[model samples]
Target chain A: EDQVTQSPEALRLQEGESSSLNCSYTVSGLRGLFWYRQDPGKGPEFLFTLYSAGEEKEKERLKATLTKKESFLHITAPKPEDSATYLCAVQSGTSGTYKYIFGTGTRLKVLA
Target chain B: EAGVTQFPSHSVIEKGQTVTLRCDPISGHDNLYWYRRVMGKEIKFLLHFVKESKQDESGMPNNRFLAERTGGTYSTLKVQPAELEDSGVYFCASSQGLTNEQFFGPGTRLTVL
Candidate 1:
């Protein structure tokens, strides 16, 4: 079975703090890894998609990097407004169904 | 363009009651998806619709759940005789095509008492 696991169920950071969230996966073939930010009572917003190893994408204070067995969402000098639950998901290559297996997510709280 | 939208942002019902959640995908989007997140659990795929066709429904839990996307515009998910375990936030998402980024709605929070 394909599975995605995210670490640090909850993280509390001070303003300007930098940290990284981990998403490890085990699957037959990896098609894509996705990162999303979800606010309370709202749907998840897409952030980045990593398709292969050593690939990295960034936006604002957030950066996403992928490796052979895991993906990292790095937050640099984050602000309070950036506090939200960060979710990671993976799509398998053979599913052909476009189904995404998501992790439990990392809840981040940025304080001033 | 308006992102995916879902109706009845929150619904509270007793066990055995039926609830229907609606989703309006972005205009011209051909790929629509339904996902749910149980409390403290990961969000999971329920089904996928390509236009008006049921492209994939392997994630459906049981026959008690019925999903339809008639005419390829709006979609509905009906839970009959809902059980306590069915309580969760149901999310609707859409994308233009395969490999296209999916846009999600605020979600419908369903609570079965």
Candidate 2:
């Protein structure tokens, strides 16, 4: 069964603090890994998509890195505005579908 | 781009009652999807529609949860005789195609009392 597990269910950091959230997955055939940021009362916003191992993508203060077994979302000097639930999802290439398996998000709270 | 839009931001209904949620995808998006996140749970896929066709409905929980995409445009999800477990945030998203990214709408929070 394909599954995704994220570590540190919740994390708190001060403004300008750097940290990383981990997402480990077990899937039949990995097609892509997606990262999203969700605010309190809204749907998630797309962040980055990593296709293969060693692949990396960046946007503003966020960086996503993918590997064979896991992916990392590195936050660089995150500000309070960056506080949100970070979600990691994976699409199985074997399925050839848009049905993505999502991980229970990591709730990040950045305080100023 | 209008992104995705859903109607009735919140709905509070009684168990055994019926409720319908609507979603209007961005114009020109061929793929529309429905997902739900129960309290404390990760958002899970419910179904997918490619234009007016039901591309994938495997993720739907049961027959009581009916989804329709008419005219290859807006879609609707209806829960007949809703259950207490149906309480959660239902999200609607749309993508241009297989390679394009999905755009989400502010979800509709369903509360069954």
Return the interface RMSD of the candidates, in order shown, one decimal each. Answer: 1.2, 1.4
- After superposing candidate 1 on the true structure, give the runs of residues whose Cα lies further than 4 Å from its correct spot: none
lDDT of 1 by residue, A1-112 (tens): 8999999999999999999999999987787899999999999999999999999999999999999999999999999999999999887755447778889999999999
**Considering summed lDDT, which 10 consecutive residues are worst modelled in model 2 chain B?**
B95-104
What is the docking quality class of candidate 1? Answer: medium
As a whole number from 0 to 100, the lDDT of residue B9 in candidate 2 is: 99
Clashing pairs in 1: none
Task: List model 1 lDDT by residue over B35-108, tens digit each.
Answer: 99999899999999999999889988999899999899999999998999999999999988766667899999
What is candidate 1's DockQ?
Answer: 0.78
Per-model lDDT: 0.93, 0.92
Q: Could you tell me the lDDT of residue B92 within candidate 2? A: 95
Displacement of residue B79 (Cα, Å) in model 2 is 0.3
DockQ of 2: 0.71
TM-score for each model: 0.97, 0.97
How far residue A97's Cα lies from its native spot in candidate 2, in Å, is 2.8
RMSD of candidate 1 to true structure, Å: 1.1
